[model samples]
Target: MQYVPFTPYRRVLTLPRVRPSMALMFFARLPMTMTGVTLTLYVVSNLGHGYGAAGIVGAASTLGMALGAPLLGRSIDRYGLRPVVGVCGVTSTAFWIAVPHLSYAVLVVCALPAGFLSVPAGSLARQILAALVPAEQRRAAYSLDTILVEASFMIGPAAGIAAITSLSATVTLSGIGAIFGVTALLIFLLNPPIRNEDELAPIGSVRPPLRSWLSGRLLATLLVAAGTLFCLVGTEVATLAALRANGDVGWTGLVIVVMCAASMAGGIVHGAVKRSLPQGVLMLLLAVLVLPVGLADQPWWLLMLVLIPTNLLCAPTLAATTETVSTMAPPAVRGEAMGLQDASTRLGLALGSPVVGFAIDHSSPAWGFFAAGAGGLVLAAFGLLWTRRRRPAAVAPALAAAVRARR
Candidate 1:
């Protein structure tokens, strides 16, 4: 395709039903970013627990999300968006509201369920894009969605922490619950096209076994998405550890903001640009860029400069993964496919912190950086190899048809 500028994004935004749906999605998903930070702060400051206690609570939620995402996605695919989202919204709201009132032991015990019931807004948003936007325009749409996700990371945690510290944790947590209820209600009212049963019927019409939808191609792309997050989060942890070791811990927030900003900038360009690099290529580049972050250890500014390259690829890799999954899965099972994608990302994020932390503890912060890059490369290689093996087989029938026509 000829290289177009930001015109594609402009066209995408102007399309009917696109703008409002995007807005709803942004509000509805804010809780994803807010929850962990709010929980961390509440557990530590309000409950008078240490970081270790806060971490366990956070892991409970992450584990819940990892387990729940696919099942909920299946529900959305089989039923529809409104009922599934509404139920989740209510359950999640109740849990958040009850968190502060409960004792520490009770809070820990209930944490998993709270996360389990948390709305799968991320997957739902992607499903809407798949259903509403045409295939040709979806790349830009996904890019925009990915950018919003990054924005949530920037806004959600900051807002959540700020509110909890400034106002009462009880009020802030309750307010978060209220936001969930209202966002879910608005989504129900807007009744995005994804809510229509007839539209999703074809996905199940053939009644193909779920195994068929869980194609190798789909799984490989999911791995790429997971690896992308694994590398990104691992690097983040390593960066923090290194900063702490250097007695520059206070600068951590500024450094992260710069890196996220770089990713956002790259995402904007990736969306606006007509042609872009393949997902595999972007993942490989990220691995390479992150590998040397450890060498910049002497000075804080040096670490910031080194991180720019890897961070720049962050959004592009994510946007590309979403676009690939959207293209690979048929409409009938797209929700499940997206759900699997969601699960993979959560798994990566959950694993990244521990893996890098372990490396930092056993060796040094530099080793943590090295491990993130090396681990990311290993995952990227697996994905690339899977694609290489699958491509020729996928096209063989078409090639055979061409040969027969020649004869």
Candidate 2:
């Protein structure tokens, strides 16, 4: 088949509501990407706490989000998007607005609820994309979404740091809170579809049982998704450690931008192409490529160059994972399924940081890279084994029926 590079993206963009929805979601996610770093800065700079204390609040919030995602998603499935968004929006806005006014202890206590009610923007974006874009073109849609994610990360943290460093934390945080409220209101007003028209269930239709849709294949996909995050986060921690060890900390931003650029390039190609690597294979390559990055840690630029190959797979791996989950999940429970994907990725991020940090602390940054790759390999291996084991069990009923017919 004759291939046109821009055709896939054009097709996806041409779909009804895809363009405006994606644009709104892009802006909506900016505040989300900023919140973590901004909160850490606020805790350390304003509240007179150390990084460790700041991390406590951050960890609490992460835990809350990890626990809350599936529940919020289920709520969306049952009650629909607006009600959940309304409650979460008001709660999140109230929490962020109240942050600068609270004592450190109170802040910590509030962090969990704040995170629990934080709008499920990322998952919502994927759900909307799945609803708006047809299944056949979802790879492109998700790839584009992943590219936007990369762009958001590249912009959000730096902007947050700049804002917090220049303005008072009180002002910056209040601004963030205001942004949250405004974006939430915008999302409510837009009210994007979460399920395709054809896939919409009739009134009183029961959602399929969890066991029926959450198949072994889907579980394996989630495992791979988690592994993808594990490797990426670990790589990031290792990179920072290596840079700090080599006294190249000042160049950190540049190195990160380069890494993001590589990932964006890869995402572009992945979306524009007719076919690309499977999620498992892309994730495996992502993990494997990072294993040797620490060897080039001396010159900061060299380390950045070595990091590119692994990062190049980043957006593609993420996009493929989203596409896979969207495909495997029925529309009725897709919100919950995407929520699980979010939880799994968060768990991976939660585990990656400390585990890789410990490795870098005890041994060397090189070992951190090794640990990250090894951890990813372990998850990927387990997923592979799980699918292989289920294959025979899945085939057994068919085999029995064939044997009876022959008899």
Candidate 3:
């Protein structure tokens, strides 16, 4: 077979449905970034609650998302995209609309259900890309997707904070709900493909058993993905703690922007090149690069400078993980597999904040960086060991077959 070289972003952009689907998904994802900080602000300022109380609500919501993502993905696999989107979109909209009206106690109680039903925009976007972009070109497609994700994060929270501060939480939240409703409607109407035409199974075909597709290699990829997020989020937590400790809190936004920019730059290069580092290697580099960041924490600028190295690996690592998962999963179960990816990353984010926070609280802000990097290395080590252990068994059968043929 003649090899067709990938033309980077140009090839990815030219694919049918890739552009519009990405555009819609980008707007759809903004609410995801906005919701967390917006809810935290609402709980603290409007409900007259402490940050601790707000944290409980945020934790509850995150817990719900973590639990819900895979299940929703399974639903998409079984039922198709529109049905799942319709239900989640309406449920999520109703919850957000009711958020302003609920008491703190009631809001806390409702947060989980609301989060459980929240639109799985990020995973959906990946599913759409996998369906729309051919396998050979997916690296660039996913890289562009990762870049868009970073861009959304850069804008979303700031927009949320600005709106909440300038107006009432009631108004801001209601507006967010409105945006969710509209985006949901658009997604429903658009009904982007979730599987390539050839990969689609017949109606009522037996779904592949979980054991068949959820292989050790796939799990290892998920583990690496979780580790990537754990390191990144932990780094963010450490950066914040470092800034607060150094009386440079005001520079936090600039530092974060710089970090995002560096990640985007890395992603661009990773996609444009014919070859980039594998997910495991990129993740390892990411964790190792941040280990010494604590030493530069004195001035926020210096800390930001130190952070650029690790941050550069960020989007590339994420894009690689998505590409690996997409390749490993059968199209029949791709939604569920993607959902698992979402769950793993969410789990990482959930764990990173507190674990790193504890380190900063007990020792010094510097220790937070240590905690983050160390935790990442530990997770990556486990994935590496797991992959190695599975390899001999995986190869033995093929080797045996080859030996028998020789005989």
Candidate 4:
């Protein structure tokens, strides 16, 4: 195992952000979540686009993310977070203002660049957390970030959907756009230097292509992990909608809210762990317990109960994965590593929806949960074996031992 470098960081995670970098992140996400799912709804329902056309636009958003993430991260690595985030916010705002009127074709074109440049608020937040926390404690830092993002997802879409349905999609788009504008301003006004910049070499005459950072086994593994998580997101939400359990559209969001709340609560509790546990054990437990998520019937009252223990471990699992990525990637390529992680999750969501939706259409809506849980189990097992194989023989035993302990 490679030793993770430690930096002297203290508790901003424990206290309020004096500069409130997280606030900037919260606002920046308003458009990202809204655009990906809710805004797609607006295009199909309000705008003159077929549902199939919405799929194309969604693909464009993924394409934009895949194309843009590494580039944006590299820019942050080279120039600074301030400039890239500012540019992203500006372009995203402009895209929103245009979203209401643009032809499906135009929206597709715009989504590519817009999604790409939109300040990777999530990655930026993680970067800040990485710099702010001591390396040993980075797991908790990432858990906190994940909790915040889960909260954001819970709230952002509800607000966006309500704004679009009652007021107008245009109004919502403008509102979200304005939020991004504010985000740009906040990031610039704060102008906090990222501590991780030292990890990257000074951008000299030549910049490497996005592929250099992403086209590697390490990046591929991290992306796979991230993609799996978002697949859970997609599958869970779609199944809830298909079942129409509990109540109405609001209920669908509420169901997800329950799950997100569980995740956030889990993160809080997980952060308090002083003793290290075997990761594979926790992951397998989570995977097995989560198998029941697929069986949630109308009014999934028991789902929360089932996830109480399972949920606590989820964020930490992912956070640990993030830490691993950070440790594995050279500093010069850190941004690309993060970008791939982000892009993978985004594309995974887009991809997962169709696959799970198909299951709901044919087999049963409940299958989504089982698939996610089962899929997670398979992947976690893969991760453990993969990690062991990648390690030298001596290190492999420790990893295998950890896996055994987890199982």
Candidate 5:
């Protein structure tokens, strides 16, 4: 809870290019943030499908995005951002435009491919932040990015739901497609400095092996990133379960917003803190907060109060994951690194509902909370141990490379 002045954040904003790009990215990411919720609603409401069918479609999309992220990142690293943006933009927009008319079977089958092209807006924004700022300024940048992201979550799903409520899911889904198109156009015009050839190896220089990028440190970070989301989303599912059990479904949305506000507050503090806690420490704190939430399910208010502390750790964990990936990845393959991070997040979220839902279904709503906490702790323990054991051996190659480079 140590506070640093906002001086760092002010300086970061003062940068000529950072502000506009961030603003655009903030809007650009909205469509992406809204998709999961909006799509689920569409399938369940508009298409006359059961929750189970909607779940499958949603899961398909998540799987596609997870599979696409790394490939897209590598393409961005190799071929640059514009081409990749163009391809995804065209394919995605076309899919959405035609999708509303398709049969349910066709829609289900297309979900995976459509998601594969879902604008990589989130990853690209992180790439911009990493490339634009120096190491010292990056924590604040990451914090700011996390805050904006929280804001997007706050707005995106609500916007989608509202659109569907007022108009139609078809119109909303199609409109989101247009948003993706606009985002692509913006990225193409802005041509942000994600892949400055000068920053990377010379054109003819040999690329480092993928093994270098997938070092023990990076792998651990990826796992922790996924685990963090696992807890967050699991808690979300658990909250829903608790509400359903109590017949308080109407409170679900407001309760989730309260949780998001807690996370936003934590992000604000995390950014303002002079030296943030290590990621491992943050994960442990998160686990501690969630562990007792199960006991608080008696009353809806109690569940909200219990979730506050656990949710507070949410954005900080995500921001730290971004910062770690930024620091760990070489400039040459930073896009790929960010992509992998995005993929890990998607994978964790895809797993969260099922894992928590099963726990709640088979046992009790209380077990969902317990399972979330236990899962987080188990993952954190794995990462911490793996990192400690490999610490010496992991740095050897980099050290040798540094020595060679200095010669």
Candidate 6:
């Protein structure tokens, strides 16, 4: 139960600076879910356009994220997280204000760059937590940060939906821009943990993780997990339609609430337990746990109950994978690794949407859940194979004897 030094709790919560910085993250992400959802709605609902146009607009932002992350991660590694975060925050704010005016063509182009520029607050927050808090306590710090993120995302969409309905999406969008602009600036001015000079090596060096990332086994393992994440998120979106059709009017929001609440609890526990399980074993365990949600049915109570187990597997596995990736990545190219992690996540969501949407369209909601669950099993199987492959080869008896004799 020993906590790392500099952690808020390790310092007995006496560190106002640490507490405030963490609090800022809550505000930092509050608009994250809202911006894209509301922006898309605003385009279609207010501007009188089809879903295609909205989709294009949304895709533009993802493009930005795909392009921007590595550069920013590199910058954070080189200069510092604060300055990079601040720049991204300001850029995001400016882009938000102008997003509405751009035509569909212009919007798509803008979105790619913007997505790239958008400060990956989640990743940046982790970096700061690592720097400010002692290494051992960092797991707790990340757990707490994940909790804040879970809460923020849960609240953000509802708020965005409400704002668009009450005040108009355009106004809401503008307000969000201002709120974040100030938030990013304030975090910058406060000089959060990202400013710590001693931690420069992780953020600064530009070396590559050639050996680890290129290793066949490790890359395969990451991609498999990435696919599972994609399916899970896509299933969430598809489930809303299923609920409405099933006459469970209120279940849509409830499902999300259940998943996130369960994930938050899971993250807390994962942080508490000091299990030293290898990454591959942990992956398969989590994968198997989520594989049954595909069969959920009518008992309202049963829906909630099943979600607890599935949701529990979500955060910790992802966090574990991320921690593993960081460990394997070299300093020079750590940013690339972080960016790839994010891009992989985004890719999952992106790929999952079409497949889930099609399943729901062609068959039923059950199909979407089925795909998700089965996809998880596929990942689990891949993990098993990957682990096997990663194991060292058997040594030849005569050659082994010669090598040992030399030793």
TM-score of each: 0.93, 0.97, 0.97, 0.82, 0.95, 0.84
Evaluate model 1: give its TM-score.
0.93
**Candidate 5: clashing pairs of residues:** none
Write candidate 6's Cα lDDT for 184-284 as tens digits: 88777776665345534553545554674545455755675566576567557546655766787577678788889988887777666656454455555
Model 6 TM-score? Answer: 0.84
lDDT of each: 0.85, 0.91, 0.93, 0.66, 0.86, 0.69
| Sort by TM-score, top down from the best | 2, 3, 5, 1, 6, 4
Clashing pairs in model 4? 281-406
Q: List the RMSD of every prediction in angstroms.
A: 2.4, 1.9, 2.2, 6.6, 2.3, 4.3
Error of 1 at 32 (Å): 1.8
lDDT, candidate 2, at 46: 80
| Residue range 6-75, candidate 4, lDDT tens digits | 2212243454452266666766676667666666788789876777788888777777876788778777
* Model 6 ranges with Cα > 4 A deviation: 1-17, 194-221, 276-286, 379-384, 393-407
| Decreasing lDDT order of the candidates | 3, 2, 5, 1, 6, 4
**For candidate 1, lDDT tens digit of each residue in 205-266?**
67447776676777788888888888998998999899999999988888888988899889
Model 2 TM-score, 2 decimals: 0.97
Looking at model 1, residue 272 earns an lDDT score of 87
**Best lDDT goes to which candidate?**
3
